[model samples]
Target: MPAGASTGLPLETDRLLLRPWRVSEAAIQRELWTERDPRVPARRRIDADGRPTVADFEEAISAAAVPSSTGLLAVELKADAAVVGYCGLVEGGPETEGEPELAYELLRRFWGLGYATEASWAVIDWARSSGHRRLWATVWAWNVESLRVLAKLGFAEVRSEQHPVHGTNRVTMKRL
Candidate 1:
């Protein structure tokens, strides 16, 4: 298989390995979509028609170029080698120029085990080494778990937007 990226890839923590997505892991992506929180935007969840099916991910994995410094990395357990989730950086839009957005998602079965924080720490180090001066993360205020994780990671709330029904979306920033 191709290496995850040109650099900072296959990052290792004491219990996990941050690597590239594999074509065989399409089902895992689909699972994550299906398991999304109900409060998550509909467009982000698996639809009634099962849009963004495994085939879509297969095509994506097949066509994707080698990841750049800011690409997502698969979070996997080192003991049993099961992929738990993903964590990394993505473009945050024109306003965020040099500050990429940090993102992560883990299977429900793996929650509350410190994996998110651990994985995020690895990504943060990678981001800093990649020369990023800052990073941003957006989380729903209702997701107290994610909020706690962000807090533990040293992100400070910079802004918030209240949704009509889903509550608030908090935007946070962290200096790398």
Candidate 2:
């Protein structure tokens, strides 16, 4: 772990280790978010150019480490100690005030393997225990697999609207 990197709250599943962001994991974080196809069927944002500078990833890890902000947990594969991606709850924006929003992203190679669903369950449980009564997420209307993942996690489609900047429509979901 690098300076300022969190060892993370210990969260585990049968095969995954949900740990805090570590400075040592910066390179992999950059690869996962920037090098992976930006338009991959997930709801999380990815830099389209595949050129996230080291500083960019560092900032992200820092933000995730700030507990008062929103907790972002690095999802590591326990089998090999590989940093696969991230899962956590982000504080909702004005549109979703009073709710925490669930978010997760995985390396493309790890998709469709139940990692997202499993990690989401852990994060949601954490949020619930932390006193959050609702969790929300926004997905691009076309991302069917993500919609399914949210649904499987007990999220229901609450509404849809066009993004003012991206021009893409998004479907919002919530768990109550």
Candidate 3:
């Protein structure tokens, strides 16, 4: 289990490599925006104004912090080196102030192949190495696939919040 370059070394799994985002790959982010599930917030998807254009992602990629224990890493296939998505830890607001929250997304084409689970496992290992004892993740109720992945990773749902547009958000936690 190696950390990414920005943080130290790329986190590698049997078939995936979790690494930092590159400016040249900003277009991939835009593609993800287009492929987002309709249940995803409009702000996260492409809006009428295209709020998160390639330029926007490029700027973010260039300015990303060298995270010590949290950051999104690009998920690339070890066999072909194609970036399939991203997965990592992020601040989960006040409810999970101390414990970083797990988050992951994959291109629709790559869904159902266990990439999300595999990438998440690496991130979880990284968190444990960073001295974290617990981790959290939130998933929309309609996202059965994500719920299954979390469950396979030992995350138990602790609570749910109602969202005006996305229905219910299930908050899950796992102890390292």
Candidate 4:
């Protein structure tokens, strides 16, 4: 594992390199936004043509450069350094009070290969060592795979709420 330039902390897993977002990865980021599951909220997913707008890529690049302390970072494949998707923290969740949220996403083809679990476990460890009292994640109930990953990471369901897109959203938390 190598220390991240932005956070001064390592974020590596067995097969993934959790690195900072680079401007050159905009195309892949756009593709990620375009080809994501259709069940996601409209504002986050690409439009009907299944193509992300130019602004989407720009926004992604901008968001990625947010100092790494509070934005999603690129999850690159250690085998070939391909931009598979993203995994890191963000600032919003049901409970705010200084708790950063855990988030991860893989390109559809990359799912079902244990990447999410590996990356999430690393994140939980990082958060715990970084002095966070607790780490949290929000998952749609219908996303059973993600729910299972959260459970495997030692996160317990703290609350549930009706979602506008998905039927329900589960807010899970892990004490660090």
Q: Rate the local accuracy (lDDT) of all candidates.
A: 0.88, 0.74, 0.90, 0.77
- Model 2 lDDT, residue 126, Cα: 72
Q: Could you give candidate 2's per-residue lDDT for residues 110-165 as a string of tens digits?
A: 88999999999888777666667778887776677778898888787677777654
**TM-score for every candidate vs. truth?**
0.92, 0.79, 0.93, 0.84
Tell me how far the alpha carbon of residue 73 in candidate 4 is from the true structure, in angstroms, after superposition. 1.2
Candidate 1, residues 1-176, lDDT tens digits: the string is 22543575789999999988999998998899988989999889988898999999999988875556687788999999999888888889744555689999999999999999999999999888877889999889989999999999999998887889778989899998
Clashing pairs in 3: 3-9, 4-9
* TM-score head-to-head 3 vs 4, winner: 3
User: Which stretches in model 4 have alpha-carbon errors above 4 Å?
Assistant: 1-6, 48-55, 62-68, 96-98
Model 4 / residue 45 / CA error / Å: 0.9
By summed lDDT, the worst window of 10 consecutive residues in model 1 runs over 1-10
Which portions of model 1 miss their true places by more than 4 Å?
A: 1-6, 94-98
Cα lDDT tens digits, model 3, 1-176, are 24553354489999999998899999998898898888898877999987789999999999997666789999999999999999999977876755799999999999999999999999999998887899999889999999999999999989999989889999899999
RMSD of each: 3.1, 5.1, 2.8, 3.7
Each model's number of backbone clashes?
0, 1, 2, 0
Q: By the TM-score metric, which is better: model 1 or model 4?
A: 1
Q: What are the runs in model 3 whose C-alpha is more than 4 Å off?
A: 1-8
* lDDT preference between candidates 3 and 4, better one: 3
Per-residue lDDT of model 4, residues 8-112, tens digit only: 444787798887777778777877777756777787887777557666676767765443455577888899999888887777644645588889988889989
For this target, which candidate reaches the highest lDDT against the unseen true structure? Answer: 3
Better of 1 and 2 by TM-score: 1
**Candidates, ranked, TM-score:** 3, 1, 4, 2
Q: Model 3 Cα displacement at 48 (Å)?
A: 0.6
